[model samples]
Structures are given as structure tokens and as C-alpha cells.
Target: MSAGDDGLVPDLGRGALTDRVRATVLGRRTPRAWFLALGLATLVSLLFLLGVVYVLSVGVGAFGLNIPVAWGFPIINTIWWIGIAHAGTLISAVLWLTRQDWRASISRSAEAMAMFAIVLAGSYPLLHLGRPWLAYYLLPYPNLMDLWPQWRSPLVWDFFAIASYLLFTASFLYLSLLPDLASLRDGARRRFQQLFYGVLALGWRNSARHWARYEQAHRVLAVIAAPIVVSVTGTISLDLAVSIVPGFHFTIFPPYFVAGALYSGFATVAIIAIILRGLFGFRDLITRAHLNRLGIMMLCFVLVVDYAYLQEIFTAFYTGEAFYRGVYFDRWTGPYAPYYWGMILCNVVLAQGLWFRRLRESVPGLLSLAVIADIGMWLERFQIVITSTHKDYMPSAWDTVRPTAWDWLTYAGSIGVFFVLLLLFIRLMPSVSMHDMRALLHRRREGGHG
Candidate 1:
């Protein structure tokens, strides 16, 4: 209560603020365990190379496609991966805008995943081109003959969506990274590391003026990123919505894609969080409170998506459209009925159980459920892509397109490659947002003592 205590408060604040909190590139002790982890990840990446070789040598038919279903797994997998990336920007950008303190610990990794997964997803389009080379024809250029993209096409819309979203996410990630880069620049024992971090720090001296600008730039980027992410998913839906296919065409496609995006994105977040928490032993920072909050988000999206599902059926039956009803019935009662029902059970019913406290509180339990939800969401995208492609207004055009062993191999390998990248990131980089996290800890301590 005295003036003396007030003066000492600033001293205490500065003392509690440690450099260890901000820098995550490496700690005091480097371990043998880290290298072993990297070696294992390198092996997983090689498996992905095998899939790449198979796809390249055998052709697109290796994955199995007949006529109308020419697009197949490529488009669906692209959207699914991109959708799974949405939560990164959502957590970092939108939560930052709302001043959510929880973001301090989670945002860095979330943004990292967003950038990496987006890059991963972007590769599929080139693979789908089959030639893989000369795929740049899709891009617009000023030539003597007047070369330009077909702006009227949804595929064109997808190109723009992925490109813009990736750029925006990169900017957002780098902007957040500047302060941390400065910490590394200051702490470096090596000249090359110093030079690398120094340039990125942009001569940041951490003055009060610089701090103000840092906060402002982060907020402005978040404001822009939130809508860009939503639009990206919406454009994916447009690819299906613009189609005349009975199963694929619907007014609900945009919202449906967005919901599916959130669902899978959160699952991706959950699995990543579980691994990071265990590997880094960051139990205090990324606590059960965060898990519960994420669970709630996952549940909300599933319900919204389930509602969309109901409406799709209602519109079909309610309008008495013969083709719509027949397709709807065929989708549910058809050979793929197992997949449809499984999606409902895993995405909807299983996610709803997160309402129970014990389930959210359990680590292994929650991760298992998160994996289930991710699988269910993938099935949702697959159902949308394949079923609709095969069947449409014209019944004669319809034929089942079965996935070959190569199709299954590529899907599984993509997931392995994703984890391999994530494990390396956790080891090489700071897994938590040290600056933001310290800011939060200081605030909490101040509030508690007062």
C-alpha cells in the first residue's frame, strides 16, 4: 500500500521476465533425443516420396477414375487439407482481435501448421495436372495472343483463393515472428544464426514505440485473414456448387465447406497440441482449459454441419424433386451407406460427448476422439467429391469410381508426412509463443497479488 512497494513493482516485473521465456530455438541443453526424433521424421518423409514416385510413374488412373469422376481424390484432399488449416488463422488472427489471452501459448504453432498445411495442400493441384510440368498455363499472362485464365470457372476461383490465402498466412506468420526473431538475434552464439535472425528482426529494439506498432500490425493482419480464410473455403464450395451435379450442387455448399473446415482444422489442432504438450512438457501453458475450449468449438461446428445435412435432405424431400430424392436415397441407402452413417456417429454423436467433463480432461481419450473426428471430416469431403461426381441429373452418366490401393497409400502417406513435418518443427523451433505467454503470466500474477 505504500509508495515504496509501488516503486518496487516495476523491479519485480523486470526480474520475473526471463529471456528463456521468449527464445525457443534451443534451450540450455541440447539432447540426443532431438536428433533421434529428426531421423524418424526423415523416414516418414521417404514414405511420402514413394507415394509420389508411384503417382508419377503410373498416371492419374493409378488412383482409379472413370469419365465424369475425373477429379476424384485430388480436389477433395486439397479442400480437406486447406480446411484443416483454417483454425491456425482463426486462433491466431480472430482470437487476437478479440484479445483472447489463451492465444498467447497456442497461436505460434497454429500459424505454423496453417502455413505448412497450406503448402502441403497446394501441391495436390500440380499432381492432378498429371504432366506436373507446364501446369502454369492456369496462371494469367500478357502474351501476343492474349493469354488469360477463365475467370468464369470455379477452378480459376480456387487458384486465386489458395494463392491469396497462402500469401496472407505467410505475412501473418512472419509478422508475429519478428519479435521472436529479435530475441534469437540477440541470443545467438553463432555468426550465421545471428545474421539470419538479425535481418528478420528488422533492427527491432523493443522500445515502447515498437511494441505499439507490433500489436497494431498483428491486429490489422488478423482482421484481413479471418475473412480470407472463410472465402477460401467458400470458393472450394463454389467448385461444387457451380456444378450441375445433383449431389454436389446446393446453395448450402459454402457454409457446409466452412463448417467442415473448422471441424477438421480443430482436430488437426488437437492432435498437434497433444504431441507438443507431451514432447515439450508444456502442461502449465497449454492446459486442460484450452482443451475444453477447443472441444466446445469442435462440437459447435459439427452441430452446424449436421444441421446443414438435415436441410439438404429436407430440401430434397420437401420439394418432391424426383432426381434429388432419388440421389439422396441412393447416397444414404447405397453401397456407401456405411461411410454416411459413420460420419454421423463420429462427427456428430461422438463430438457431442465432449460435453462431459471427464472426456475433455483425459489426454489420451481426447486425442483418440480428435483422430476420429478428423477421419469423419475427411469422409465428409470424400462423400461430397465422389458421390456427386458420379451421379447427377443424368442417370446414364453415373458410374461408381473406386479408389485403387495407390489412392489409399497416397492418403495415408500425406498424413504421415504432415506429422513428420510437425515433429521437426517442435524440436527445432519454440513450440509456444514466449512473448505473448509471458505477457499473460505477468498479468495473471499481478491480478492475483493485488
Candidate 2:
């Protein structure tokens, strides 16, 4: 079947398609559901802020950290958020480079998701620092005292990785938005609206020169973004792998983490795509085909994750090292055994549902699987961070570390922060890319699949 036959972009005039997207931001009336969701998200974000204040005031002791298990929700959530962020780059940059038409409808939101998820991911390291104000110590700058950041510290590596990715994502997102922002600038009636978009549009004139330069710049950024996507997660994985902890010290971690990150990321994109379609009524633009493609992507990466899981176990046993074998045994029968099995069930077993074409194309089925995949990925991080550290070499030092109320609050609040930002973003800006959709329509008219 041809791409148009699958309804990537429904048969609509350029003006009609543009109007449908513009109306989401420029419409006279707003959706009640958006307001409700925003209000709830804002409340939770406030709670997240409150949690931050509590942590700053009371110290990182507010989290569930102990002797061996110094890493807690902050580290787990950081890795989880970073993994979630990967899909945005993959969808927006990698797929764009590969000339995937389906990415047009979703890339804008995916980029936005990447932007926010990285911010949240970057915030955790600061929160984990006992004295977050001293975070600048990680930055390599000449100071009066001539103090330099430890060059070998993984924490230093994380700072640079997150910072670099954040800059790249922001640039990538804004660059892609130039054409769409120009559209909003032209379509907006109010002076304030025009000025707001005009500044962001960066003087885009829709001229041939502007289009050529924009495409060149965007393609360059996409090329940079492809490697950034892999390296960011790989660096984060190194933060664990560099450690001698039995669960963390694996040569397979870099690729395993990369696959897991993309798996969670695509799952998040699926969730966001479903939410966007339902909230903004983009059912025709974002069709069952989009969901099916997302399902396929999720399945492909998750199978890699399932293989990595087995490889980890095999490596643990093959080494003939008591520590490595004991770690897996503990994972199976220790206090955190349930979490280990839960991750297995969600990621390895339940994820197999995507093999069925019926399930891949079912809205409810895809959404459920996506949510489960995210949960499983989170559980995977949870086990890697906590279970790995909780049981160290010294039997006397081995103790269970449970998340305190503050940990739950902070984790849930971070989620709230992400949704609140996303909700506000959709309300203010075009959630779908008007220009990209227009191009898709143009391709359909020319009887060529883009």
C-alpha cells in the first residue's frame, strides 16, 4: 500500500490542514479537558516544587539513601527520564534523516518531549547532591581556589552529557519550529500573538533563501542529534557500568542501555501521541498507522532489551564469580525480587503482545502496552540502581533501602512537572508541525511517498 493510502495525512487542502493545527493554539474557545489536565498538573508541579524546597532545606537525607544504597529515586528517575527523552531525538532527527513520512505528524511533540525530559533528567543530579549549591564544582571553570572538577568522575561525565544534549535538543527543536512559527506569525490576528511568534520565528520570511538555510541548518542538527541520542544514554549507562558493583559492571551495558532508552522513549512517544490525538482531536492526522508504526518500533527495541536481560544473566553465571552470580540469585530471591520479576513480566513477556498485528493497530492495546513498557523500563532502572548497591561485598553492610515518602513525592512531582510543561506548551504553540504536515500533503498530491 502507498503511504497516502495509510492516511499519514488525510486528504485536505493546505489551508485546511494549517487551520486545523493553528486552531489548537489560536482558537477562540479552549478544550475543557486541557484546562482540567493543566490544573491537575500544576498542582502536582507545585508539590514537586515543595518537595524540592524540602530537600534543599532538609538535605538529600530527605530521600531514602543509606550506607551502600546512596543512590535512590533521584538516580533512578534521572536515568528513566533520560531514557524517555531519547525517543524525541530518534523520532525527530533519526527518522527525519531517513525520510520517514510518519514522523512529520509527531516530530514536533516528540522534540518538545525530549526537551522537557532532559531538563528533568538533568535536575536529578543537582537534587542528589547533598549540597546542590555546589553543583558548579562539576563545571570546569577557573576559580580563585584553582579547584578543578574530578576528570574521571562519572558525575562530571553526566553533567557534560546532559548539558550538551540539552543545548542540542533546544537548538534542534527551535530550528524545526522556525517554519511553523512563521506560519503562526502569519495566521495570528492579535498583535501580541504576532509579536510572540514573530520573535520566536526569528525573522523567517518563507523566502527561498530562508527555506534553503533552514533546511541546511536542520539537516546539520539532525546529523548531530543522531549520535547525541546514542551517546547521551551510553554516557548515563557508563555512570553505572564504571562502578564495580556486580549488577552495574557489565560490558553489555552501553548497548543494553541504549536499546532500553529507545524502548522507553518510543513508549513515551506512543503515550504522548495517543494523548495528543485524543486531546487535540488529530485522529485523522495521527491515524492507526502511526500507532502501528510506533508499536513496531517499540517491539524491535524491546526484543533487544529482552536479549540483553538474558545476556546479563548468562554473563553473571559464566564468569564463575561469586559476586556476579550472587547478584542474579539475589535479584531472583532477595527483598527486591518482586521488582525484578515485574520488570521481566512487563518488558520480556507482556511486551511480546506487539507481535500480533491486531494488538499493534488497536488504540487501546497500543496505549496499554506503551504504558507497561515505560513501567517495566522504570523497574529495570530501579533494580539496577538500588538492588545493585543495596547488597555490597561486605555481608554486614548489606541492607535494604526502601523509598521514603519524600522519594515518592519527588518522583511523582517530577512527572507532574513534565506534564504541566507539556500541557502549557501545546496550549501556547502548535502541537503538530504545520509546515511538515503541509509538505506531507504536497507529497500526497504529487503521488510520491515521503
Candidate 3:
């Protein structure tokens, strides 16, 4: 649906993606703003490289973890990053499969985040390994050591789960990009930009026939990716649930992890949107209306988390199970009480404010919530990782895992890395999916309700 499809109001509900997509991809506008985005993103990328070097040279031991708290920063970071990773394809592919047109603008960032988040997250499991080089042992291979990977282990499951997600996310990101790349290829004025996008376009002509086939294939891929994101993280949740651990071993783990993933993922998206809008001056694209839509979704996610947290506590203490009760007590009335309370305040108290219509729509308020929610989600993951391990069945093995400099730096560097990659994605690529947005807007112009 082009802008001319409908004689009536066109592109009204089409969202920011369609409004500015043509200018972005065709290089119709000036490049001064993009140059600035490139410079900032480059600086952040350099910092990320330095961080990786330090992490590799120093070894995983430089982070935190003793016998009981063996899974600390790396694991926690993995969960948080992976959670943030889910929203990309989850919203893009999943929602697209369900025919949610409002998701158009957010899908590009969502898909990109899935790629980088997995890249960043996939590193931690290897980094935390005793012999990082020997990490491939998790893969299932016959004729290898007589000792096969324990199918019962979550760590082993995570290897396949994350790997599958990374592949699917990469494929999904590329598929969505091809059309836009074609638009850039056909429209770019500069020789270098033409050459760059031309390769990605793969000799495509942006004919109506091509767009039709591409859109159909894209819809199919989204259908595949949506469930993959949900299932992948659910498997991760089982890594904790199937265990003998009290706070963990339950059917709720699947939904709990899924909800947490959305909670963290949407928050990360909001943070990215805020940055992209600020740096790129694409307030026309990543507008307040779009932010409001996502903010509301985030608001809902937090509520789901809060509800889940309550049920978790209720089941633990109310069930009369000694193990669950003990875990609950250890977290609530124990040394980790401060962190637990912080989680409650941040995740619950702040979330309740979204009940008011104004707060969800406010820029400053939504921005603050997005940043705070990220911190809250990180702590929530920490609560899951630390609380469970800190008060395990064996009291002798229980100990607090305080982070070292390496842990903090590595995590800090990842923050820089996400922004670094995101900033570049904004400059070099369309942060918003232009082709899809254009179609949706075109349909809207034609008076299509969707």
C-alpha cells in the first residue's frame, strides 16, 4: 500500500516507520546527522573491544563466585541479556505472525537486539567456563568422549537453545533487512553507500512481484520465530525448575521466565528508542505515540511480573513445603533481604504508577521507567540466581557471591556494546523497518483497519 492507495486519510495509524522511511532508505535527506551517529557509535564500539580484551585476558574467575554461588555475574548477565534479547523477534516476528501492524517500527530494533544480545549473551557461558576453549564439549557428538552431555542439565539445554535463537534471529533480521536494503540500493546517490547496500540487497529490483513474495516469506519466518523465543527461554527456566531447588522446581518457571523476558525486553527497547530518537532526530519515526504504545506494553509486563512474584511467594510459604519456606525465609528474613526489598519496590511500586494514563504517556516518566525497569529486571534475575543458590539444600556450600571488578567492568562494557551497535545500526541501517511500515501504512490509507 503506497501513500496513494486510499483517497481518504492515509498513514494515520501507520506509525512513525512509514512516515519517514522513504527519506531514510533512499538517502533523500542529508547525511550530517548520520555522520554524528556514526562517530558516537564508533567510540562506544572501541570501548566494547577493550572490555572484551580485559575479560579474556583476566579470565572468568576475576568475576564473582565461590563453591555455592558458582553462577554469578556471567549467568546473571546471560539471563538479563537474553531476556532483553527476546523482545526483538518476539514483537517483530511473533506479532507480525499475529498481524499486529503497530509493531512495525519496533521490529527492526527488536530483531537487531536479538542478534547482538545473543552475541553478547552467548559469550558469557563460554567466558565462565573453566577452559573457555573446551566449551564446545556441551555439543552432542557421537564417537567423542564416552561421557555424553547430561540431557538433564540446564546448562547443556541452554547451549542448543541460545544457538538456535541466534541463528533464527540472524536469519530473521536479514530477511526483514533485504527489502530496505533494496530500497537503499536502488535509491542511494553516493557511490560508497550504493555499493554497501547493493551487496546486502543481493541484486534485487524492488518490483511489486518481489515485494509480494518477500512479504509472504517474512510472515512465515515471523510465525517460526515467535514460538522459538518463547520456547527457548522456557527451556532456560526449566534449567532452574527441573532442579530439586525449592524456589525453582515448579511448573511456573516457564511462564515466569517468559514474562521476565518481555519485561526486560520491552524496557530495553524503550531505552533504545529513547536513544535513537535523541541521537538521530527521528522523533518523526520513533514518536511519543510509539513510545506510549510500548510503554503500555511494558506496564502490562511489569504487572504480570508482580502477579507472578506474589504467586511465587504464596506458593512457597503457603504450601507448607519446608524447602520452599526455607528459600523464602532466606531471601526475605535473611542477608539478601535488602536486595529482595529493592526488587519489590522497583518492580512493584514503580510499576503501579503506570495505572495512571498520564504516566504511561509522559516522555520523562516513560524514559525513567524504562531505565529503572532495566535495573529492576537485572536485580530480579539476580534474585532468581543468587537467592536460589545462596540458600541451597547444603548449608555448608552456601555463600554470597560478591562481584569483583572484572564482573562489573564486563557488564558495564556490554551496556556500551549494545548502545554502540545500536547507534551504528541507526546510522548505517534503518532502525525502523521501512518496507513493512510502508505496506501497513498503505493499507491504512486504503481504509484497512489493521
Most accurate candidate by TM-score: 2
Deviating ranges (above 4 Å) for candidate 3: 1-55, 142-147, 448-450
Clashes of 3: 1
Candidate 1 per-residue C-alpha lDDT over 1-450 given as tens digits, one digit per residue, 9 for 90 to 100? 332131111222422333543334646554465567667766766766777798889777777677788878877789889998898989998887787766667888898888888887888887888888767778898768687889999999898899898999889888887777777787777788788778878998988899898888877897898787689999989988998878777899898889889888887888788776676666656777777777777887888888998988888788788888877787788766777888888877787876776787679777877898888888888887877677777778888888877777777777767777776766555667656665665665555321
Writing each residue's lDDT as its tens digit, candidate 3 over 1-450 gives: 455232212234544444455455555554676567656656656655675676678765677788777888888888889888988877887777777666776778878877899888888888888568888688777855586899878878889999998888888888888988887776677898889999989987877788788878887887788778788888888878888876777778788888888888998888777766775566655667777778878888888888899899888888897878899888888877888888888899987766666776677888888877888888888888888987778877767777776677678877767766766676678787877777766666666653
lDDT of each: 0.77, 0.91, 0.77
lDDT for 266 in candidate 2 is: 95
**Model 2 lDDT at residue 378:** 96
Superior candidate under TM-score, 1 versus 3: 1
Where model 2 places Cα greater than 4 Å from the true spot, the runs are 1-3, 447-450
lDDT assessment of candidate 3: 0.77
Highest-lDDT candidate: 2
RMSD of each: 4.3, 1.4, 3.6
The Cα RMSD of model 2 versus the native structure comes to: 1.4
Instruction: Give per-residue CA lDDT, model 2, range 382-422, as digits (tens).
Output: 99999889887777899898899999898889999999999
